[model samples]
Target: MPDSLLVVDDEPAIRHAIVRAFAELTVIEADTAEAGLAAVRERYPDLVLVDNRLPDGEGIELIARIRAIDPDLPVVLLTGHGSTDLAVDALKHGAVDYIEKPFKIERLRTTVSHLLDKQKLGRQVARLSGKASGRSHLVAQAPAMKRVLGLIRRVAAVPSTTVLIQGESGSGKELVAKAIHERSARAEQPFIAINCAALSEHLLEAELFGYEKGAFTGADSKGKAGLFEAANGGTMFLDEVGEMPLHLQTKLLRVLQERRFRRVGGLTDIEVDVRVVAATNRDLRAEVVAGRFRQDLYFRLRVVPVPVPPLRERPEDILAIADHLLKRLAPELGRPGLAFSDAARQAMVAYAWPGNVRELANAVERAVIGAEGDAIRPDDLVLDEILLEQRPAPAQVSAAVQAPIAASSAPASAPALPPGTLLIPPGERHLARIEAMVIKAALADAGGQKSKAADLLGINRTTLYNKLKDIGLEQAESAAG
Candidate 1:
């Protein structure tokens, strides 16, 4: 469909002329502010044109009314030859641009074209702002992320589809939920998230289904409303639902079936109009098989599942995410801003990243703290030992696993070595290599018997085998024989 326009002119001839000029435009005509306001309520136009002097209202007045419905809608004001002052006033009041009655066809066309482009950008900003606070406007261009954005758009239109966001931890499920809520019917309402695994059953129950005063000892004298009640007419995101206890799961399932709950010690049942969007890393279906979760509850929450992929699955997003994080962290860190070095960027894309986004964030935090220059480097990422363990070894590293003391395969460009000499590069020596050498030397002395070799190496047999594997020196089968 072509772009739609609402023309608010007192003269029918003027509206007809505009409609004729932009034949492809869908025009909605209104002669007065009342009619224009009604038109806006009935249909949202992509662009609006208003006469500076309407019979019942000023064009700026209609612009103000339109602003109430959609504050950022682009408006163009029409003015007479002597109404330049009124045109300026209209522009100030949020009309994007103004044109006099005698405006050239070209001038009007150009103005309208520019206004439409501006509106397209506005729509994009509006779309992105639905995600993370402040920076949800940072939209991605990657194909996978583009697909993710499309899913967010389609799913957000539905009011209460419990989105089951599955992803490696730290892949920004919470941000996705926030974006959905921001773009939905309840955009202006509250959005609350409770981490199901973060608290005990009694506390989780008390917090989720609020306890009335004296529901339990040490309770505050005044009772509290639960998150659902507090987030009434909005959204309540139950994060990490896989961690919720069995007893609380039943209450949660009941509330999902009927949006009503009883406070822990209160007689009155409270009803709420809250939409639930839950997220988790655990496979609830598997949990069901394990008898730790309710299948019915799983069905309810998975009404519209949104699985955010792991960072490793979308390594292409690492640079963008890193760029965004750096921009955000710079001012917060009170330091000179930084970005990732090419090597660092390569490292990020190559790493298996088992920790996902949280770990990526921590990695960036380390860079921000340790970096002495303008960009983050591989050296700056203080990865957890576990994550390091999961990463792939260098090509030469695999060779280290095969034989304990092979010729040191140093690159061949160095100065000539002395006859029968071994020269190990600086920083190239490692304990594995040393242990491999010792084991080889000892085995040679012991005539290849592991028991004798172990004694000769001064270590137990199992420890010798472990060292053999560690240093790429597991004995050859024939040699072991």
Candidate 2:
């Protein structure tokens, strides 16, 4: 759908002109700030062409409200020569761009398009960052992840569908739930999280479907609302849905099937409009097949399951995550952001992370606390044991970052190549190895057709032929034949 725009102008002629110029958009006409605010609150627009002067108030006053409603919404101001100062004032209030009166219509249209695209991109960034409005969430950067982010953006526009987030422990599924909630129509409403694994059957049910007065010992004397009720107009993030007891799952499934629900000890059915975003670390399909989890409930909770990839899949992001955590944990640790030494950063990138982001966060925090100077060295990190475990059998730590394995360790008779079947020369020194692998794969895929392989590799046939010669794959192929 074309993004909606609210054209707020006191002059009928100006409003009509804007409406005609931006005919591609769904324009909502408002002559005053009150009208604009009402229109925005009623249906938040993608862009607002707010007049500098409104009938009841200055357009700038609406900025806080507009942002309060949806901070991502882009607001532009319309100004005359006399109101240029007022335009600046509006700009200070969060208006992205201004259109001066007697301005070129083309310029206004171009500005509008550029600003809209920018606003969309910013929204996507915020969405992918998995942050709630004004609150930072987890940052994940895996190819599998960017795909999930795209899904979040697509799914956010349609908030009614349930979303199931699946991942290994500490993979940040909860963060994704919060991102979806923050982007949905019910963003301003409360976000309630209940860990199904953390509570027993009776307690979990009472906590979710709220107990009435005297429903149980130590219950609120008057009454209390459950997370489902508390999150009436917003979201209920059920973490560890795999752990929810079967009885409770039936109740939750009923709630999902029907919007009306009953509180504990309350006969009256309380209705709520809640978006359910359930998450779990366990293999739910296995649970379903094993009869531990209800297949029907599983299907309900997993309307749109977003499985987060383990940290090991995205080795490239380790440094980025470390830097982000270091910056964030600095104030808490009473130390300003010190830099990571080459060794420290390399250790992080080299280690095969098993526990994902939570482990990484703890590792960074521990390193920060142990670190004395402004730099974190390899020793500062708590990764030696983890690294040793992931390395091949008969593993040993090599001090040389640049030296070949033969120079660092191993008997002269042993192969210089690491114990691993595939020898990946250090990325810098092993360019030839990588080239060989690339050429080998391409040639295999093309059945040794050099020209087609080169095209697939995005290089000229001559370059492919030369690379093939350099790798000595031609001699091997001929000998094998």
Candidate 3:
């Protein structure tokens, strides 16, 4: 579907000009704030361009209202040359950008294109992260993790049951929480997450339930909606739930029991339909016994307890998970096709991984960026004895397991590798070139088979095709040449 642009301006000339300039886009125009809001509710456009001087009210005010409806929506303000201050204020009020009245058509088009591209990328990233949080992406080759996955699947179908996930830090608790949320009936709704340990008690309360206008110092003038409100009709993941202050825990228990909560300083009770998924590294049972946590709240949260096993207990999954993460991380780090040597893989598998999967990902990312060639050596990893003990004997990393690692076995279109080599010339390591190279190699390896190539590269066939289309490799000749 073509993207739509909403132009909210009282000036006919400005609106007509915008409509004429973007003949490719579907332009919907409104001359007043009320009309613009109605258009927004009726047709959710990809972007909004609102003049600061709307017929009924200020564009900045409309921007706030638009944000209240959908915080992710992009709004741009149109301002007079003398109203630069108002433009800045509009940005502070959640307008993504502003344009002076006498703006160039090309500049406006460029700005709109840039913002649309940004929104597209944001959506793609969100989709990718959602996929990453699935059960399959959790890397459960080991029995312990397999059992954890089983438990998660069983409980995920229960929509309203509050889940308390206990695990060591970096043990993929959030991933499990997200998997449950995704599987539940509320899958289409929001999945808001916050760390209880990251904020002060007062701040956390406001964040959870929100506050009224001027309810506290430094608060937004327009009373903000809290995560609970934001997550209405969805799921909320409370990470480090054991760190919640006792006073807030009491309020949380009330919400669990009543399914309603009042804003921090507001009189009205706000109702929300949201599933609560709480996770913590600490033992809440122990915390309750020690008088640091409320027993009643603990029971409320642990309606179904899910335990995420640490990496040490799931040693068999270390290498496989590392390989999975490497494929995902390589493109993001702008070093496509980077892979760990057999020695480094052995070292990774042998390590205790005290910090769990999070640490492993960081180490892999560091190694990928630091590697001189496509093959990442132990030296490139810079892993000290503190992170890894005695390295296990070297084992061959399978070409099937890591397609980019075994470039020599790749197709004829792939650039010639000297021994174990695959890279662009020095100082020319651009993402596009590396991406094109990897795609060509994968396609070559699969004998021009897109689906098989996608499998080889650890990505979906559609994604592979999209990447090829994006990098001007859609045609066989481009891919081969």
Candidate 4:
């Protein structure tokens, strides 16, 4: 839907001009503060433009009332007698921008467009953070994840406690942070997240603690509020925080210690009440020992340490998470009612997910897009293919494939190599023995065709030849040829 705008002005000409200017939007107009507040509640416009002089009251007062109704709704105050004091008061009461009378149409349009775009983006961020859909409701059927959830509950009860989440990449560290924020007393406030490793040191610094206007070359002329300032009275999630530069780490330490920070090139400290949740895949203690991280900051952030276990450690969650992800993804991708076959489920549980939840999400998404039938098969998941692509050791391959092979309906005493099939006997655990058995089975299944045997083994002919040489079958194959 196109964005909606609400204009509260006593003058009919001003309202008409705004309506004409924003013809594309569903413009709502009111002649008095009472009508404007009523329109705001009923129309639910994305932005509000109010004139200072209204029939019943001043628009500056309306700004606060409007904020009380919707704190995120952007308001622009319009006035003929514009003064520094009026502008300050409007801003203090929650007006996003102030405009003097006889403002250029283009300038008004640009300002309104910018504010609407910013508000829309903020809503999208909120949705992605799981605010819209009970994002705090995480899947914690596994005891490990349940413990992490318990930690989140305990820390969330304390509004200002700093939390440091340590985990491997893709283990849902940010999700845990969001859970804490959503369950806390500040759930209604903003939750801002930034990746410390994703930006350069200077840019990261400027982003976390905003810079003053013209603080440095290429700075925003109007200056900008950084994530720290934006997340006041809420939560600030610092992801990959171990990668933060050492110099900036000192400033961050100060913020944690004093709850105050100075904008870049600014003299005065700006005090803020923000709960910080920092996450890292790397071990910050190791980084500190190596002089890459601040020792003081490390200790401060570690006050409420929450370690997120890797997906492999919580084996029971594999199928559960896959099912959860499938339910969420199917309808989104226009492929609903898709499910994993029993074999697929066994394969998912057996394979080790080194990339953790992120990889599983990707795998499920790929399956949802590519599955041709109602149920996803093991081939669709391609668990064995992933292992083969990794070029794992023979023993590693055996461990990964053993369970799925056992789950197959093949007879226990079946011939080792039925045509186009290979089977491993029970109680076979030796790596070299299994390697030899698999190769010989492949050769037999291929009718002693070495090239076809290599294809059956999911390896190139050269690799197969080397394996044959290792098992002392090269001479026999050459003689047979």
- All candidates' TM-scores? 0.56, 0.59, 0.55, 0.56
User: What value does the lDDT take at residue 250 in candidate 3?
Assistant: 88
lDDT of 2 at 458: 74
Of 1 and 3, the candidate ahead on lDDT is 3
Candidate 3 residue lDDT tens string, 1-481: 3568999999999999999999988999999998887676545577999888876998889898776555667999888854667767887899998888789999999999998777766655764576431122467777788898788778877788899999999989988887776556665578899999999999999999999998989988998899999999889999999999989998899899999999988999999999999999996754663457887898899899998887877777888788877765665556766877887875666566778898888888788778999899878767667435433222443333343332232222323557423455667535456557767877787898989988877778788888888877786557577
Q: Which pairs clash in the backbone of model 4?
A: none
**For model 4, how does the per-residue alpha-carbon lDDT over 1-481 read when each residue is reduced to its tens digit?**
3568999999999999999999899899899998887676545577899999988999999998877656778899999999999999999999989999999999999998888667656655664576643233367767788898788878988989999999999999988898787667676588889999899999999999999999999999999888999999899999999999989999999999999999998899999999999999996754653457787899899899999998867766777789878865665566767999888876676666778898888888888888999999877875545442332222222243345444333222323565554455676545567668767877888888989988877778999888889988998768988
lDDT of 3: 0.79
Best TM-score among the predictions, by candidate number: 2
Q: Rate the local accuracy (lDDT) of all candidates.
A: 0.73, 0.74, 0.79, 0.81
lDDT of 2 at 143: 58
Q: lDDT, candidate 3, residue 191?
A: 86
Model 4: what TM-score? 0.56
RMSD in order of candidates: 16.8, 18.7, 23.0, 18.5
Evaluate model 4: give its lDDT.
0.81
Better of 2 and 3 by lDDT: 3
Q: How many backbone clashes does candidate 4 have?
A: 0
User: Tens-digit lDDT track for model 2 on 149-204?
Assistant: 77887777897899999999887788788778766677667788889899889889
Candidate 1 C-alpha lDDT tens digits along 25-78 = 788999998788666644557788888788898778888767645566788888
